[model samples]
Target: MSGHSKWKNIMHKKEKSDAQRAKIFTKIGREIAVAVKEGGPDPASNSKLADLIAKAKSNNVPNENIERVIKKAAGGQEKSDYEGIIYEGYGPSGVAVIVETLTDNRNRTAGDLRHYFDKFGGNLGQNGCVSWMFQEKGVIVIEKAADVDEDKLMEDALEAGAVDVNSDDEVFEIFTEPNDLHNVRVALEAKKYNIISAEDERIPSNYVHLDNEDDIKHMNLLLEALEDDDDVQHVWHNWENEGEEN
Candidate 1:
């Protein structure tokens, strides 16, 4: 937990260009569509949908866009049938990698991912090849500010059913059971904590360090390629890239 500062990754994402941010919104919209189709348009009754709505808001997705996507999805206006897929592999220096994607065409997604990995000095592997090295958890991140009380926040999070809290100069990271994410987030919001992000994430059991400059370069390229893919939603890796700029 100490090595995995999720805030670093969050800040990196926040610094992306406008076009990349739009791509992020589109990917999240697809997720919202799927959630609506599975449960319903009403976030009140659908916990998954509720969580996704919170996630969308944290990413600065506008309320109108969220409502429009929900309405369209509920009306069956979205015709694309997307399925969730998880791909596990290893990057340079045996760094474990897991990619979560939602794609209408599995063949195209697989081919693109494999090609990227190969070109970047990595290899896509069979399912569970690297997934076993990670654990799924609900992570809630809050931006640390001058007015925020660290002790009070920790107490509030624990009272709200959070398992643990980790902090750095920039943020407070609260960990919870995967199913308890929504409830904990709601509790924190009720307490008036400004949540930066709340979503389920796969935390690596251990991290891999790249000593060679080539390994580091290739690892970064591989991660960027996976993240830039239209079908890829979340990319998790075991690289201990705490100080390095991504």
Candidate 2:
């Protein structure tokens, strides 16, 4: 998770931008709608919905908007049938790229993603082509503070069923099994830890370093292009930032 943290920091900065925030809200709204349809509007009765609510709140999504979307979805007013789609491919320098999208039209999303990969000098591959390099894990990031007790936090996370607790000067990355994410997060919340983000993520087993100037440039373009698509919810890749951690 060396370069990944920096990459996340970069994306977080982008999320602060006006355009990206609007896109984030739209994407998160679709997630809420789907969660409501799958489970129920009641977060207490629906664990998935509850986790999504927490995720939305972490992203600074307004409470009113979340309630409105849940109501609309529960009322059967949101007729757009969106489905989750995953596309696996390689970006510049053979960096494994996994693009997750929630879209009503599969063809449109596929075409748009294919175009972005092609335009950026990357070729989209068949499903599982690049995903084999990744693993599904529950990742929780907590911003490190001066007064925080690192050892106690690690012990707490481990006791909560976390597989690993990686701490640096910047943040504490707690890893857990995919199914244990919400439970571990809940435990940490109970302990009053400042969680920056908690969600399921694809952790790459090995990283691909992009050192060439052209490779880095094209890789950035590919990522930006993929992220700009409204259908694309999350973009996971193994591009290692060749620099020290923040």
Task: Write down the TM-score of every candidate.
Answer: 0.95, 0.93
Evaluate residue 74 in candidate 2 and report its C-alpha lDDT on the 0 to 100 scale: 99
RMSD of each: 1.7, 2.7
Candidate 2 vs. truth: CA RMSD? 2.7
Worst 10 residues of 1 by lDDT: 2-11
Model 2 gets an lDDT of 0.84
- Residues 1-246 of candidate 1 have per-residue lDDT tens digits of 752356676676567524577888899999999999999999999999999999888778999999999999999999999999999888887889999999999999999999999998889999989998888999998878888899999999999999999988788899999999999999999988889889999998888878888888888788778878999999988787733633
Per-structure clash totals for the candidates: 0, 0
lDDT of 2 by residue, 4-116 (tens): 46446445545544466777888889999999999999988888888888888887889998999999999999999999999999887798999999999999999999998
Per-residue error at 214 for model 2, in Å? Answer: 2.0
